[model samples]
Target: MNSDPDRQVPFLSYGFRPFFLFAGLYAVLAIAAWTGWLALHDMPGVWITPTFAGPPQQWHAHEMIFGFGMAVVSGFMLTAVPSWTGARRIAGTPLLLLALLWLAGRAAIWFSAFLPPIVVAIADLAHLPVLAVMVLGGLMVRPAPRNLVFFVFLALLTVANVMIHAEWWDFTSDTASPALDAAVLLLALMVAIIGGRVVPAFTRNVLVMRGPSTALPRSFAWLDRVSLASLAILAGLAAAQIEGPPTALVAGVAAAGHLGRLSFWRGMATGGAPILWSLHLAYLFLGLGLAALALAHATGMLAVSAALHLLAIGAIGGMTLAMMTRAALGHTGRPLRVVRPIAGAYALVALAALVRALGVDLLPGHYMAVIYVAGILWVAGFGIFSAVYAPILVGPPLPKNPPSA
Candidate 1:
């Protein structure tokens, strides 16, 4: 790979370089603070400002989705789209500008009460639009021969944020609060779409690099269409008020489809592959989360509370950490291995999901404890990745400079 040409290069000479590092590090600190304050009742609900919705839930959802989650997406897109299109890397001041905008949004939401609602709203909605511009800009400069239209999903994510902002500003009805749910579903849809391409491709790349004898399974035919269609329909249903029966039916089918798709990835076989397992475990949460939500509605046995946690904490949080860590390592010219502590981070997340899903009723008041643990594990995982990979994201190039030859 060619060296980055920017003059203001620090440790942030690449997109994933700084954003992934800061994002991952922030993942630990933000969630820990969030979980602790919530658990200990140390922080007031009004600690954050208002916009579309109350700061309480807004703070939580925004950080998880756009803060931690969007950071991961930004890192991946900035890193990958350049490679895909042969475009110049986004680095130095421009990258910092984007990161600061994200941080500003987090701060505005955190102290939203002190600031005008419009101020918070502007800062909050700024990151994704900036990101969409950055990504779509790549297409304009040097369009990827085939993946030009992929920006549609990134654009859709931006649209989802518009709905989210509508709720923040009371432009929508009282039911507008559910726009958060719509945003979550939209995030899930993006994960399914992009994760579908990258994880398998990366795994296959690693296997090929190592040797043909170690090739991961390659059957990706039905999964692409089925998961996409299911999520698209689900996204629409999530936005509108659909009847219970149709909702239940779609949820059940999505769960099954996700699970069936995941099975082909051979997660069990990839236990030794930290990069692979991180991706697999994240995907597992997606499948299990869909199933958990479906079963919740179908039987009325579990509340959406547990299911949402499963998706947010488990699927979204877990996968973002996993993918960001993996991509950061690879693109930064580091080995693909997750250090022991980082791997332990994954274990902590798995335990968190189990505790959150199974323990809410079993150990009801301990939600804070589970959340605290989850936040700690989650943050620690990303924190570890930041420590290890920040150096690699900058720097010149790999020592040996070997491609998958």
Candidate 2:
């Protein structure tokens, strides 16, 4: 096997190279389309007609979670697994084929009306399992015990996706919401697992690189295990749609466990660096969102959708953007620094989370307006990231040795 990857064409040489760009582009276009549909679909002379299977709301949520979120995950895993397990990375033909699978899923969902429901579901559902095979198979070669839990989450996610499609195909009744809820919680668990590792490490790296003698984060074994177990239990209960005092109790306990887990991470020291701070903030949103979810189950004072948005836009969206930016720069051999526009991009996404999660609840009279504003902010933030990173993603990787060197 050739050790040197063909870098003449950068996009196909590495997993993160193309998938990050595609995920960012899709985030912008999907949200814009969803917003247009929401604001104008019922108007007398709307120009763009949105056509798809299932209710518009479900379609939007499905695309955001299963479509955009999965793309980011695929990119990250493809690149990160090599580092974790010392296995050969997926590149060249294999990488391109995986990307095509993802693209095909997106297109099948968009034009689902023209195809049979089962066909559409099959097309959209094939990517994740293949992704799992690639990741777990690679890990099997090296056998990392700690990272093995990701396979369990991936399995649960695939089951949720199947339930979602089952509801759409009329094989089941009202399964989509609980399935989506389950999927969201599973992703949050991944965020917890990944974020717990990366956040403290990144913070420690920055401080050490800058010659600071700060006390780094300490990991608590009991808290870590408890948090993961609680989240897994929550995902199962959510999928079963078991609500009432028991559900509320589990949610509350899970929330507290996660909060305790985060407190051990040195989030306060990450303030000066946007790249590091964004991740801490995103993880913070996860804890807060889970707490709000507990409140929703207990008192019914807040809409479940609000809590969902907090996890969706805040945790998933924020963390993906932060990771993409950092990974793109690091893989390209550039300095670990955030540009001004990218910093602004991070802020815009955070603002989107705030407005979507809280603004709609506080100002009921202007619900649509709030959504439109949040959509615009979300789109613009991702659009900015796409534009800024396109050159790096498509062009040759940054030269290892500059002419000056």
Best by the lDDT measure: 2
Q: How far out, in Å, is residue 196 in model 1?
A: 2.0
**Cα lDDT of model 1 by residue, 1-405, tens digit:** 234535655466667766777677777777777776675564555453233236566667766776777777787788878787777878766788888998888888777667777888799788888888888877777765446655776676667666666766777754444556666777777777666776677677766766667748565677667876886787677778563667677877887887787777656767678878888888888888888777877787887668777877778777777877677666656677878877877777777777777777677777566666666666666666667666665565565667675
Best by TM-score: 2
Score candidate 1 by TM-score against the native. 0.87
Query: Which 10-residue span in candidate 2 carries the lowest summed lDDT?
Result: 1-10
Model 1, 257: alpha-carbon shift in Å? Answer: 1.6
As a whole number from 0 to 100, the lDDT of residue 198 in candidate 1 is 68
True-structure Cα RMSD, model 2 = 2.1
In candidate 2, stretches whose alpha carbon ends up further than 4 angstroms from where it belongs are: 1-8, 42-49, 210-213
The residue-by-residue lDDT of candidate 2 on 323-376, one tens digit each, is 999999999889889898998999899899989988988999999899999999
Question: Any residue pairs clashing in model 1, and if so which?
Answer: 28-379, 49-112, 49-113, 51-168, 52-167, 52-168, 52-169, 53-168
Stretches of candidate 1 above 4 Å error? 1-10, 42-55, 141-150, 206-216, 390-405
